[model samples]
Structure formats: structure tokens, C-alpha cells
Target: MGSGQSAPTERVFHNEIPISFSQDLVNRLEDNLSTPDTTPERQNTLDNHVRARIQAELARLQAEEVHVREQIEAVLERENLDREKALSGAGAGETEGGREDTTSGNVSSSALLQGDLEEVQKKVERFHVRRQLDNHPKVKDARDAVLQCYQAKTNTPLDCIDSVEQFKRSVAEMERQFVDSLRR
Candidate 1:
């Protein structure tokens, strides 16, 4: 910059919330909806699920925001490196009239960026979500309890407190197990 003072640097913030948590939450909601029985609890659950989904979506957006900022930082770093190379090259290749030529440096940097973009596009084309295949029987039992309570206490969803607690415990236990497995 031509200014005497330096410009402020951009700061990127990262959220440590695992995206998998939201993914599993969505999967469980879908599983619950797969049941044939319709009850008032299901409606309430659906409403709650919708709210959860909105929150999950917000989290996903935040992740994307972080990713974009990281990409921008990477591009800026590359540009700085390219600028340094170009300046050095221009100095070495100065003409009799003191004109600096940087065509080669500019071309090479643009080509490098193009190659990177193409490689990224190729990887993106091959991307797919990995879905969990196994369903734990313990979780199945807890889901049944919640489902039963929903059917029985259609008028008063608060009656499903015990079942809901059990379901929460089961899911939390399963999530712990899943994370532990990944560590191994």
C-alpha cells in the first residue's frame, strides 16, 4: 500500500462443533419419521426437528464462511508470493529505457492458479457424503419407548418425559461410542 500505515489483517474464526453431530441429529429425525404410526408427539417432534434443522443449517453456513475465508487467505498468500517473484524478475529484466517486463511471471502465476482451480473442481466433482450403515439395537429400543409414549399420550406430550430422557441418553451413549470408534 502507498499509505504510511499498514492495513489491518483479516481474522478467521473457527467453530469446534463437529458437523457430524448435526448430521446424526438429522439422520435420527428422519429415522423417527419412518414409523408408520402418526401421533401428536410426532407433530411436536417434527416442529422441534424443524427448529433443530434451521440451527444446523446456520452452523453449516458458518462452516462455509470459514472455508471461504481460508480460501481467500490462501489466494492472498499465493498472490503475495507471485508479486515478490514478479518484482524480482522485473528488476533483473530491466530494458535500456528502464522499462520493467513481468509478462513471464504474471503468466506463470495465472497458470498455477488455473491448475489449482481445475484440480479443486475435479475433487469437488468426486465428493459424496458418507452415511452410517449400522443401527444399534439399544437405540432402537429407546426409539420404541419414545414412539410408544407418543402414541399413548397424544393429548399430553409432556407425559413422554421419561421416554424422551431415555432416548437422549441412548443417543448420547451412541454418539460417544461412535466418536470412540473413530479414535481407534
Candidate 2:
């Protein structure tokens, strides 16, 4: 009734619009308006058409992104296979004269051997400690006496209190001797 140009209404779903979508829409709108055939009367119609096209473009880009990610994963898997093949090929060419290639694999193998050596050393140390404990005359006699007492009084362990105490004292003395030996 007045000037035929109503006031611009506030957009209802402003927050729902993505920045990229809005930017593309704005660029297209600018292009459409700059053309000679465009008129102010058809601006809304052109804007609607541009918005639809932008939505379609966003969907296409998302699909392309998923496809590109899949391709990247395939390429990485292929590269890993090639690397394994190269390592195996290098290992096959090594001569059996105890001459090993100086690759990371050889280094890891040496590390594994070192770990095994350390484990063996620990076992040897344990064996020596056990032998020393068993070979001590006092400890050996006390252990044998305790075992005899327990066998004689299986239902009454309390009766073997003296032997148990002797075994404990022998163990303490053996530990002291071991520590003294270590200090020397």
C-alpha cells in the first residue's frame, strides 16, 4: 500500500547457516546482481536458486572428502606392504658367515639377545644364591632338622617350635654372611 518495498525481515535460521555456504551464496548473489539482465524485483528468486545450488555443492564436497580419505588409507596400506617386502628382501641377501646387515632389524635382534643374556644372568645369580643358602652347614642342618620334626609331628607343628626358631636364626646368619661377602 505504501512504497511497495517492505522492511527486510530478520532471518529465522541464521545460526543454522554454515560460513562456507553463506560465503558462496554471497559471492553468487553478487555475480547475479552485477549482470545486466538482473533486476531488483527478482533478487529473492535468484537468492533462493543460489542457496539451493550451494547446498548441493556442500553435499558434493563432503562426498568427495570421504572418497579422498579412503584413497589415502589405501595408499598408506600399500606403502606399508612395500616397506615390509623391502626389509625381507634385504634380510634374504645376507650371507650366513655371521656377517649381519646393520639395519634396524639387526639392532633389534641384538637388543633381544641382550635381554635374553640379562635374563640368563639373573637366573644364574638366583641359582648361586640358592646354592649358597643350601650349602651353608648351619642352614642345611637346621632345614633338615625342621623337616624331620615336621614329619615326626605332622598334626602338631607347634611341637617343632625349637627347630623352626633354629631354622630362622640360620637363615638370618646366612643373609648376614651373604651381605658381608658382597661388601668384600
Candidate 3:
């Protein structure tokens, strides 16, 4: 022992564990730890499940699309059939009361009646105006008669022809129409 120093520091001992270990011990401890599951395997399983669900939804939507298309096609086909039936003159041969709408045939008759009524009304009006201009005292009475005749024939008042010139012009036009019709 050295002078003035204790013979030796008392040695300490512990049985729980050593403060440091060998490199091999640490390596062995790490190797004994359980490994985690593989990332690729777990990912693959999840991907397959997602893919199946997506495929099912796609199939369902596709079926709905097909159904909608079928309904549209059906409506279009019905419209086409109706169009074909109408274009083929299917309604032409159908008869009612021994006739199929003679409205077109009555046009000539109606025109003739209209022409006769107009001509008669024009003659009555011409006579009335001529009588009025001839210094007749019954001008008012003649005018009233002309007005009644015009209203009865045309279902219109005599307000359109306020002068003899207008009436003459109307008569000339009517005569020209009649002449043309005769020529035709």
C-alpha cells in the first residue's frame, strides 16, 4: 500500500445483471426476436379484396347501363312503328258516313256562294250610292238598306268601303277574279 492511501477500495458485486454484455449476446438477442409479417403478402391480400369489390360494382353499373339502353331502344322502335303506319296512308281508306271528310270538296261550293253573296252585296251598294248621288231624298233609307244587305251577306259592317271609289275598286277586283276563274 502507498503511504496515506487505504489498503484498497473495497470491491463491489451484483447478481441481477452485468452493466455491459458481449457483442455476440446482443446479436443473439436480436435474432431471437419474432419477425413481423411480410409487407408484400399483406398488400397483395388487401389488393385482391379491393379488386373484387371494384369488379362487382363495375358489373352492376354495366348491367344498369344495358337496361337503360334497352328501354330507350324499345321506345324508339315503338315510335318508328307508329311513323310507318301513318306514312303508309293507312287512314286514307277509312270511311265515315259513306264519306271521308269532304271538306276539301266543299271549298269550291263555299267559294261560289261567297262570290254570289259578294256580287249581290256590291250591286246593292252601287245602286244605293248612285241613288244617293242622284239628289234623292231617300238617301238615308237606301244607305240603311245597303248596310243591312252587306251585313247579312258578309257578316261584316260596311265600314271598309267609305267612298264610291273604294266600292268600285272592290267590284273591279271581284270581276277580275271571276274572269280569271272562268278562264281557268
Candidate 4:
């Protein structure tokens, strides 16, 4: 049971039992048990030392957290500025005057961060549905003409050719206007 010792390390007889540990473990146990920290003065001193160490560590961690927060805030402010500049079309994907506006002087970081991105967010939301009908009435009239021509000339479809071409041209014009608005 114990590395096949020549002599039994532990002996137990009936209800009485004895344990034997290695020399190093026995010495460490004795050293811990025989410490003079049992006195009230030493015990109080040890407790105070532990408390001081804990407080110090907590202060260090709080300082580190403050530093990290400042860094994150700085980064957020910078990113907000970049987004504001891009959305305003000041640079329009050009990085030449990105660091500071040469013509308009230096833009304040606070001003950039002041926007809650509400305008930019609204524009982004509208971008997906930007193809709203600007001249819906005209397109609808052309489409109705094409449909009516197809209905009237079901037998000779070639007779509806002019109406179909008119409808296509109207739709093409609407698309062109939509594209132009996006450029602005």
C-alpha cells in the first residue's frame, strides 16, 4: 500500500489508528503549527498586513479600469468623427484631408461625437427603400396604356408595339431620375 516499505509506516490496532507521513510533509506541518503568530499582537499585525495588501491590489485594478475606459471612449469618439465626416460627404472616400479639415479649420472631436448618429441612421434606413416612386402617376398611366393595348389587340399583338415601347421609355426615365437623386 505504501511503496512496499520494509517496515509498516502506519499501524492500526482495533479502534486505535496511527498515521505516518513523509519527512518533508511532517516538518512543514510542524513549522506551520508552531508559528509564534498565535500571540494577539502578531496576529493583529498579520491581519492588518493582509488588509493593506488587498486594498492596494483593489486600487491598482480600479486605476487600470479607468485607463481602459478612457481609451475606449477616445476610440469611440474618433470613430464617430470619421462616420460623421463620411456621412456629410466632406471627404467622399478621400483620405487626403481626413486628419483635419484644411479649408474649414480643425473640426472639434466633441462636435463629431455630439451627433447620436440619428441622421446617419435614418439615411441608412432610407437607402434600402430609396427607389420610391417620384413620378408614380406618369409611370402608372403608361403601364395602364400598355395593359389596355394588350387587352384590345390580343389577336394581333404587333398592334400594341408602340404602347409597349412608350411604357419602357417612361420606366427608363424614372430609373434615370432615381439614380441621379442618389448621386446628390
Best by lDDT: 2
Runs with alpha carbons beyond 4 Å of true place in candidate 1 = 1-134
Each candidate: what lDDT? 0.74, 0.76, 0.60, 0.74
52-88: candidate 1 lDDT, tens digit per residue: 9999999999999999999999999998886767655
Tens digits of per-residue lDDT for model 3, 107-150: 32344356657867976776665544434334444455566667
For candidate 4, the C-alpha RMSD (Å) to the true structure equals 19.4
Winner by lDDT between candidate 4 and candidate 2: 2
Q: Which 10-residue window in model 1 sums to the lowest lDDT?
A: 125-134
Q: Can you give the lDDT of residue 83 in candidate 4?
A: 65
As a whole number from 0 to 100, the lDDT of residue 107 in candidate 3 is 30
lDDT of 1 at 53: 97
- Candidate 2, residues 1-184, lDDT tens digits: the string is 7554586667666567566657889998888778777666687799999999999999999999999999999998887666555654664345464433434443334444566578679768866875666589998899999999999999998999999999999999998887765553
Candidate 4 on 1-184: residue-level lDDT in tens?
A: 8568776778766745577789999998898799845668878998999999999999999999999999999998988777656655655233453433422334444454445366568667667556466547778899999899989888998998888888899889888877876765
RMSD of each: 46.7, 20.7, 24.7, 19.4
How much does candidate 2 score in TM-score? Answer: 0.32
Candidate 4's error at 160, in angstroms?
A: 0.9
Worst 10 residues of 3 by lDDT: 99-108
